[model samples]
Target chain A: MSLVFAGACSHAPGITGRSERADPKLREEFYRNLGRIRECLEAARPDALIVVAAEHFANFFMDNMPAYCMGMSDEYEGPIEDEEWLAIKRRKIPGNPDLSKRIICDVMQKIDLAYAEEWKFDHGIMVPLHFLTPRYDLPVVPVNINCQGPPLSPLHRAYELGRTLRAACDAQPERIALLGTGGMSHWPCTPDSGKINVPWDKAFLDSFIHNRREDLISYTDEEIFADAGQGGFEIRTFLTVAGATEGSTGELLFYAPIPVYAVGCTVATMAVE
Target chain B: MSLYCIQKLLYQLNRDPYTRQRYHDNFESLLEEYELTKEELGAIREGDIGLLYVMGVNGQILMHYSALIGQEWDEYIHAMKEGVKSHGPVRAGIYTLLKGSES
Candidate 1:
């Protein structure tokens, strides 16, 4: 099986940007779990990592948002925000256009896909990379679901995307790992930025960790916004992972609501047989 | 939609260093490109984070702009709250004031 690993983690910029502001104990625990992800990801020894992220306005915007996009550049650079502000230095990351094209072509057979030869790394990507591949050594295939804009892609489509991605990864000779990174339930950038719906998040994670397709994709946007805040829409990332790892249950490596980080941060991996 | 234009301006400013430079060096010229409302123009000109927040700028874009303008994290959050108080709840967009979160 070329699909060696599949996991998800939170990619809140505050996880790195406002690091010191969060409670030390909670913050360390979160970091430690992220480190655990790094360990597991390294143990898989993937040739390329596909990060299915719900990016902010950093790249795709309302002007022309794509429901799904994959990076197709041989090289990309990022932390598009001020390096000092994001607390991650801007550096070029390697990409494998050949691998991307093969995956994109396969996904296109089952899904309408958008390919970008040019992609800049925003916190949605950089934050995860900072922990999972701190050296920037692995060739990355970046995927984004427009979680920021309204009228998002349907939940079923997101799940289908995971299934499609799995087929594509299985076709490849290189060992591939998938990491879906996003927030749980927290109000970021609003006045209620620190508010977190712990119960709602735990419920969602329960559905996700168990790979319960119906429960994972059953959430209505209105309900997510009302209960989990708009940020909760990012569950699409987790949903995608669930879609890819269907029939295989998952393990929750870590989960906590660190208010300053503006997310019920999560780290977990789905078993891939 | 003037809000779209307003957001477009901030989006360009936040994403592109060239646009950021143009905004810093010849803001009027750069501002001319976007069809903004007088209030939006005034808000941008004054770096009124509160007013901009109240006008319904997406927090993701606005957050980077806040950092660009050198507002600390707490100050940025405060500005959004202050915006709710001064200009009323967010005029539009998905980022509502979260009921009683209005400070």
Candidate 2:
């Protein structure tokens, strides 16, 4: 099997255990969920991982923000912007530039989508990765989806992008695991910013767990942002991941509306059959 | 004025050490670069979050500014709430408190 595994999780700074010391129960549950996902990754044993995550202006800003960008460098630098907050030791994650270049070439030739290279890993990629590849040994291809600022790509478009990613992975020789990271729902920095929509978050987790693709794709970006909160835009990453695992089933390993981090945290894995 | 202008500056301030150094060296000179009103400048100078909120600054921008000034996360959230009461309704941006007026 080319695409051996698929998983998604939220990446908040608080999850780093640096600043927001989450309650014992919350921390335990979060760690347990993370451990469970790590177990799956270990079992899948993919040669390389293609990680899709949202960027918080860590690499790109308004001056030059790409709707989607891929890293094709041999060595990808980790997060440096929020070292104290994220608590991730500064280092370079091993990169699989050849695989990244292969996917880039495939997308550019097949779908006419051009992606920039040389981007670094932000907290979005590094935080979840700390659990997935604690040794920092897995070769990674980082793809950044812009969900931070306005003028976001449509949810359908993100799903389409995920499909494109699947096609690229299928074309490759090595086994690959796709990890889409970010959001269940929690607006960051807004007035009612930290407020969690438990019902909405639960509905999202249920949809993923049951593989309700139609229901998940039905909600437009506007609806998500309005009801779920602005940062809910990050859920677009999950939609993209779901697109990759078409016709596959998934299970929600864990989900919690963690107020400490102001994110409706969740972890789910999909079959890559 | 423009929430974009407010946010852009804050974004830069949060990320750019050089700009942050510039801000610390001379707040007015840095303020002059952006199209901010006197009220906005005053709020920024005094770290007057309530005025900034009332003047239509976005929460995304306001939160970082609060942190830069050393306001704890809870205090930062409370400041925005207090801003609504002390300064009146939110004038603009997405966080413009409508009914609850607390956000």
Candidate 3:
């Protein structure tokens, strides 16, 4: 079975770019966090990475929206800058369809969950990729959740999905790593922007790293929504990490709140027993 | 009213009241601008923010209506697309709704 190290991440744009004009302090923190993540990846050396993140209108729409989608593609793309980020293209990655199929089948049969195919990667997947594997050489299997839409998966459901994903990864012979990317706090583009709920965000980061599944699971949607603000759409990433590290413990690697992008960026490593 | 309609209505409530009044008054013209139908209008009149949100009405339309009815458009778009890139053509309705509406 492959190892799954998962944790929450921030997807704010300013943090992802390498412009020298950015805030020096925030940029310093970003690089610091990036270095830490690199250490984790080197240690894990996963043959394949299963990334779970939220979709930002990247693939689905009103015409045909899927509550959950999985990328079965051989390659994925990062964010674009040449064409104003809109022209950014996806690179091909090796997808384990057999594993993907197994995961899909098991989740459906066991949990009454269904997912759409042909999923694409967005910033939720890209930010971590840029930070963790900037070279774009690693193979990744992408899973996306429709956090913006109603009928969001219950937190418990997401946890269960993670557990199932862990099982699926175990079923595969190759070693794997799972990365969950999103936020801790801060709203995008509002008067109260850049505000960080330090205490609450820290609590979440602590619980996530310590593998406080029961406590994390106990949180109500309203509670998370209240804490995360609109950007709280990121909590889904935590749920993904939780699922990947089923019954294991997590270690807090780093946590920093970047006021520039209004995100409480954090990273953690999960060691499944 | 359907859940969709109720959600849209709530979204209207979240907008400026003057904009809501103008929407109530010139419902047809505004609906036409958005390519909305009577059913959709009925949905909005009933305060279906989710439906309106799902229907892809530009928040700017709300701002325009707010301006017409002498209300403030103090809100701003955060420019979230600043650093992100797209892998392909993203769907429109949901993106449009999310782009135009306030959180």
Candidate 4:
């Protein structure tokens, strides 16, 4: 078996984990999208999944944040957003340490990338993982991109990182799937956190799934930030996945502007030809 | 003055239990370690959402601090809305409401 699946997921626990009594429509649609990803994973039957996501100060802080890092731990700690209300909460998520270590060594040797032996899974990884592999049965290799502050990696560089990840995965024998999770524009921690840029999000989705716009991959961090807010930089996740599956076109499995989540929730699976 | 410093402190508190304990043990002294103005320190110690919102703490970091202090989700969110009324437009950062009333 080889690398069979690649996709991107939006992880805003506020929306995905909202109370049942809250906007029923948004919550229902959110899960429906999650279900779509789950179905794809089941169909692919990947032995291990590689999750590329940004850390929300869970594992590292401004003092020392790596540009890109892979977790080589046997098990990752928590959903980090440990508040009782947010629906997505798990004490620990299993990790494919063997494969994770393999990718780390591969990346370090091949791409000269740095890595950490331990990393806690925050909402970025856990939220999507909860939806993708709910039972925690499937092992995960978590990769974190620095989307927290400035000195961020360039968009194209993120894409290149994805390509490197693809190579690392291909070197392994287990059937592996790649998933990038974060952002469709809902700025968190800003006054506009309550807002969602529907048109911006649509354009991004259209470019990825329908139009196949090459230029979409080149959009700079400033460009994305100007259009979707700083949080939109999380789209770097999508860029990496797209870069890894360069020739493949994606199918939009889910799209909904969930205001409560303060994010334009979207998910898609790519079929590399 | 330094939103970064404010966030750094809060971020540490959010992630590290020991940091939280130290902060709880000596709020004033611990806060002094950061380069914060009186207004910012007061807002943080008092848990003044309005003042902190006006002071321009990022919501991602601020929301977790609110939770640590036992504020409900809706209340934490609303405090931000009320922050605009009580303190004024966001003082700085990405959330800073720009001119022309554009949020």
Candidate 5:
């Protein structure tokens, strides 16, 4: 069975982009947390990691779109602007094709869902990849949720999907870990752009790593969206992690409010005993 | 009220420069559309950037208001810092902040 590590993630714009300049303090904090994640990855040493996250208009468009999509390919790209970084391409971490096929078949049979054979990794996936595995050698099977568009999946449904994904990962003997990335809170644009939800962000982080799955499952999308601001809906990605964990405990590592970008960025790791 | 509505309003403000002036000229109408109270309108008009920050309005909305009132980029950034500082940190995505704040 795969061990799942899930928590709130912040996809700060500059951090995800090719910019070399960074807040020295923040950069140190990010590397420190990445070190911890690297340790966890080494200990688990899973054959594949089923990563759940959102897509940033890179794959799907305003036209034909799926509420949920999975990357079934053998390799994918990281977010880098320079042709050099792009040229030093990384292969899609191999996915358990048999397991992925089964999960897709089961999800389609059981629910009104859709799947995709190809998906390009966006900042949502890339930023974390840079931190989780800077060397870009780790293989990951990616699953993306469309949290931005209308008819978005509700919190409960997202959680349930995670649970289903967990079952699928477990069906295979290959070890796996799950990573969910996104936000704590921020409005995304306006004079008040860099606002962070100190109280709410902390509370969500607490509940997430502590295996408070019920609390997360019961949370309404409206309530989260209201408290966490517009970017808050990304919580659904965490729910996916919670499901994969099968309600296991997680450890909160870092929480920093990046004022420049208006996001309360956090990094956490969850594992099963 | 809803974050979606707030986001939609901000999106409109960022996309259209004249909307800011329209907001200033017909602040009452904007309030009616958003169903904001007098205090809310006053809060935004008086540059209560902190209160505005907590209200979850985005940069595009502020830019629209600033442009409508003929405020320059420097002035807009100043007001934004003041407002954002009032509340600690704003939660908007970094990309939006950079794009909206850039001259």
Candidate 6:
């Protein structure tokens, strides 16, 4: 079986941690859209869910940061921040090592990759899971791109990673759902945390939802920081999703610049071709 | 720059219960394990969120550290602002690269 569902969304900690701070109407709208996608994901009935996220140093540090990493564990735990801080309780999330090993092996054939037996879920995965897998029943396969550190893999490589992931998932018998979660254009964690570039985010989404490969990979890191701020580098995750569904367009279910959430809150899904 | 070590320390403190225990039990001894500059040492010792930001700590790592140390969301953002105001901008890391650029 191939990918049963393909989608992407934002995973800013503020989505859950500071939920009450955002405009209630906008938050509900954003969440309703998330619910829409969740319904779509469940309808697909995937055997495993692949979350391609940009972790914030929860597990991988710069000490030995792999450009790309995939989880290969029977069990994983997440929301590594204080329980009150993230507003998500810590729990042991189930994983399918067999499926992960198969995907990792297949992905490695085309691109250099790292496989981790142990992974701690930061908001990157936890926040999204809170909305999509509230019951936490689906087996998860976590992928991390080095969006936090410098010398990240080229955007094309991220795209290639996605392409390879699609192939790997296609080879397996189990149905899979792949979702990339990251901020669009916002500064997180600094004093400029609430700053958002709406036009920049919309333009990128336009390219992404349309699956414009060339335009998506054309951004330079310099340009991203100047306009989108450091947090914008997480575009790699989006790029990977776009790469997976290359030639297939996506649907933008929701988008709103929620300053308190510190991200242009987004929920979108791509057609798995 | 010992920035790497500084972040490494915070990274450990944020994720590792053992490290957090050491951080609570013998803070000084735990601090000694990292190759931190005097400024970094002072920043960690005082839990000066602003100074740490100014010293070029990545917000992703620093944010967790702030939460671990009990700084609320608004307080963390304010701390980074104060850090830039007092220390005159981030000295290194991604921020410097962004600030240093002609763009």
Candidate 3, residue A48: Cα displacement in angstroms equals 1.2
DockQ of each: 0.56, 0.34, 0.07, 0.43, 0.10, 0.86
- Model 3 chain A — which ten-residue stretch has the worst lDDT? A80-89
- Per residue, candidate 3 scores C-alpha lDDT tens digits across A1-273 of 655455556665546432344578767776777678767776777777777777655555434556566666555544422112222345544566666666677566556544554555555676677678777777777877666655467777777778877777777777777877777666543334577888988887767776677777777655555666656656767876876776677776667776755677676777766
User: A96-145, model 1: which lDDT tens digit per residue?
Assistant: 99999999999999999999999999999999999999999999999999
For residues A78-156, could you state the per-residue lDDT of candidate 6 as single tens digits? 7788878789999989999999999999999998999999998999999999999999999999999999899889999
Clash count of each predicted structure: 0, 0, 22, 2, 26, 0
| CA lDDT, every model vs. true structure | 0.91, 0.79, 0.59, 0.78, 0.63, 0.92
Write out the backbone clash pairs for model 2: none
Per-residue lDDT tens digits for candidate 4, residues A133-235, read: 8888888888888886666888778878877888877889999999988886777865566588889888888776642436667676666667788788787
Each prediction's RMSD to truth: 2.3, 3.2, 10.3, 2.9, 10.0, 1.1
For model 5 chain A, where is the 10-residue window of minimal lDDT?
Answer: A80-89
Instruction: Write the number of the candidate with greater DockQ, choosing between 2 and 5.
Output: 2
lDDT of 2 at A159: 80
Models sorted by TM-score, best on top: 6, 1, 4, 2, 3, 5
TM-score winner between 1 and 3, please give it: 1
TM-score of 1: 0.97
TM-score of chain B of each: 0.90, 0.82, 0.30, 0.87, 0.52, 0.93
Cα misplacement distance, residue B86 of candidate 5 (Å): 23
Tens digit of lDDT per residue, candidate 2, span B35-59?
A: 9767666777889877777776655
**DockQ, computed on Cα atoms, for candidate 4:** 0.43
A1-273: candidate 5 lDDT, tens digit per residue: 544344445665545442345487886787688678767776777666667877655566435667787766656655422223222243444445555666677666544556666656756676677667666666677787876654577777787887787767666666767788777676554454567888888888887877687788776655555667657777888887776676478778888777665577787877764
Arrange candidates by DockQ, descending.
6, 1, 4, 2, 5, 3
Candidate 4, B87: how far from true, in Å?
4.3
What candidate 6 gets wrong by more than 4 Å, as runs, is: none
Worst 10 residues of 4 chain A by lDDT: A209-218
Candidate 1 segments exceeding 4 Å error: B96-103
4 against 6, candidate with superior DockQ: 6
Q: After superposition, how far is residue A264 of candidate 1 from its true place, in Å?
A: 0.9
